[model samples]
Target: MTFQKISILFACLFALNTFSQFQVDADVRARFEYRHGFGNLFPDNTDPAAFVTQRTRLNVNYKLEKLTVLMSFQDVSTWGDTKQLAIGDNNNSFSMFQGWVQYAFAPTWAVKLGRQVISYDNQRIFGGLDWAMQGRFHDAALLKYKNKNFIADFGFAFSQESQRNENTDFLLQGAFTYKSMQYAYLKKTYNKGLVSFLFLNTGFQDFTDANNTIVDGVNYRQTTGTFFKFPINTINFEGNAYYQSGKATATKDLSAYNLALEAIYKPNNTVFGLGFEVLSGTDQNGSSKNKSFFPLYGTNHKFNGFMDYFYVGNHANNVGLNDLYAKAVFKTGEKSTLLTKVHYFAANNTLINNADTYLGTELDLVYSKNLLKDVSMNIGYSHMFASNSMSLIKSGRSNNNTNNWAWVQLIVKPTLFSNSK
Candidate 1:
């Protein structure tokens, strides 16, 4: 069915259930961003220019006793450009992001069907792709069960056809989590600290294009990870490690591993955080050539420095990174805070091994404040310094070696109704 028809149906459903044994909630967000760079350093190197983009999202959630339904739609477009295409259009006009339904058979058992986001275990093996302008969604079915700190999940997808691909491919995955300790950390004092184990398996079906050429065989991918959070004194410490095996676009078996550690200290209105991460690279003999790390469930903005050079997932393998990050936050007033972050990244592998290494450093500054009740604003700036071997230098490309960008954002949230227990 068309989006318009679906929207109308939802509106009717919501109106008809005003007094039923169900509850409904909605959230809306609008964002605008302006980005300009001084260099044409990457493969898509073009003329240096500036542009603004806007994003609007609507989220609707309905819960009836143990059953739930979720729907979200997002529109993205460049400002002041009638002829310009959407920011990241693989093909379609406004993307139909997520539409799903979930049903619970028992208090601890449930199943979900339809297009939705599949995020599990630190988001290394699976994630919602929230960084993109339109983000990413998958068509699949998921089953979940949780009881007394034990959780198990199973998921399967029959297709991976983005708007660009007319043919459909299949994928499947499964994961499990167990809570080992109760009240092991400050954040979980009421429930205890928990240990989690996760496993995922995915496969894609072989299909030919309209040209009748054999596309490829069904590729298999797998991931496993463990996570723990514990408190030391007034500080909280969290760490995770994961390993992944899969076939990349080249059909070559790829192997990768990642390790992350984070410490957060919170005292009254002040907060401080430190993090360290290491990613393994593929061996030279083409053995386990997929030396790329999976970020899993991290707040991408909080890691990889402020420049967002690494998390963009552009030159993944070429930009071997050993990153160290630190941040400090202070509440200036009742409704304002100042945050500063610094990142230092150096080449993990030999510079001579790959030419893409331009060891880099990034600095970020942000200030956030409440303008009024339910209204907030944020201002941020980032600066990146590229090393000699970095891709930012090309004669035909924009000559600016240093990259600088800034943005200002405003948000308004109004609640229709809320209940507290």
Candidate 2:
């Protein structure tokens, strides 16, 4: 059906339904960044880069007795990318970030379909990467069940380039997105802690030929993990363990693992935490099987370091990482706070010639303040101190250069309309 016709039908349904709720909201954010070495080590004789990026979103939500709907329109662009008087945007930045519908068939069972955000326990494997200008989403369907202390979800998806009468080859151009995916998640809650389990299966097209031709049907991989959080007095302990197996490519086999543990202590207005994490890596000398563990479709920026030296679209399938970090959050004022974090990084596998395992150390600081009821501001800075081994992994880049990044961001979220029965 046409979009206009569907809108009219929804309008009619809204009018006929007496017991319903509707709401509209907006999220506008702009950030300015100064990057000297933001994703990678800085090269010599190169100037720093600075730019501003913005993301604007409009969300409409509706709810009835057994149905819920959400439509989120988003636009993301860098400042000065478009002319002031341009008839249209230079690049197509407008898109439907999320358009989903849910229907509850039973008291504790429901199904959701369409483009939506799928995030789970600590966002280890699935997350809504809201830190990026254009967040991540999935076009899939989910079967959901929730009760007093138990929850479960089953998800499935398939991707194709376009409508074609030929073979079913997913040649969608862009990054290496999955060809198909399926997952199941279960969680049980208790008085003091909760534990969750996730089992994911993802498939990729076998593009083995030099010309990017599809050879085999598909190669599949599996990820199984568990996450748990428990509290003891004023301290909380959380951890996760995950393993990956199956085919990484048409030829290479995948075998990897990730383990993490964290402890947090909250006292009064201050929070302190210490964490240790390790992702299995492949040997530098080379191996027939791939052992690097990649955390697919997760908020990786929240880990490692704010400088994004690992994962955030880079450092995949290479020497994996070992990150030991500590963080502190302090309430500076009634409406302001400060956060500081330090990370010590190393290679999980033997480096070339078995070089030093210590990669580098990073320091991150962020200050946040609430300006108004629905407005907030944040400023952050990060510095990276690299070692010789870090230079080896980063393509022999000079680690002697000073590496730092800074950013300032402003966010405004406002409720435009709301009607509840």
- lDDT tens readout by residue for model 2, 174-281: 444889999999999999999999999999888767777656679999999999999988899999999999998888999999999999999999999999999999
Question: Which candidate leads in lDDT?
Answer: 2
Q: Give the TM-score of candidate 1.
A: 0.77
Model 2 collision count: 0
TM-score of 2: 0.95
- lDDT against the true structure, per candidate, is 0.60, 0.91
Regions of candidate 2 where Cα sits further than 4 Å from its true position = 1-19, 173-176
Whole-model lDDT, model 2: 0.91
Alpha-carbon shift of residue 350 in model 1 (angstroms):
2.5
* Residue range with the least summed lDDT across 10 consecutive positions in model 1: 178-187
Q: How does residue 357 of candidate 2 score in lDDT? A: 92
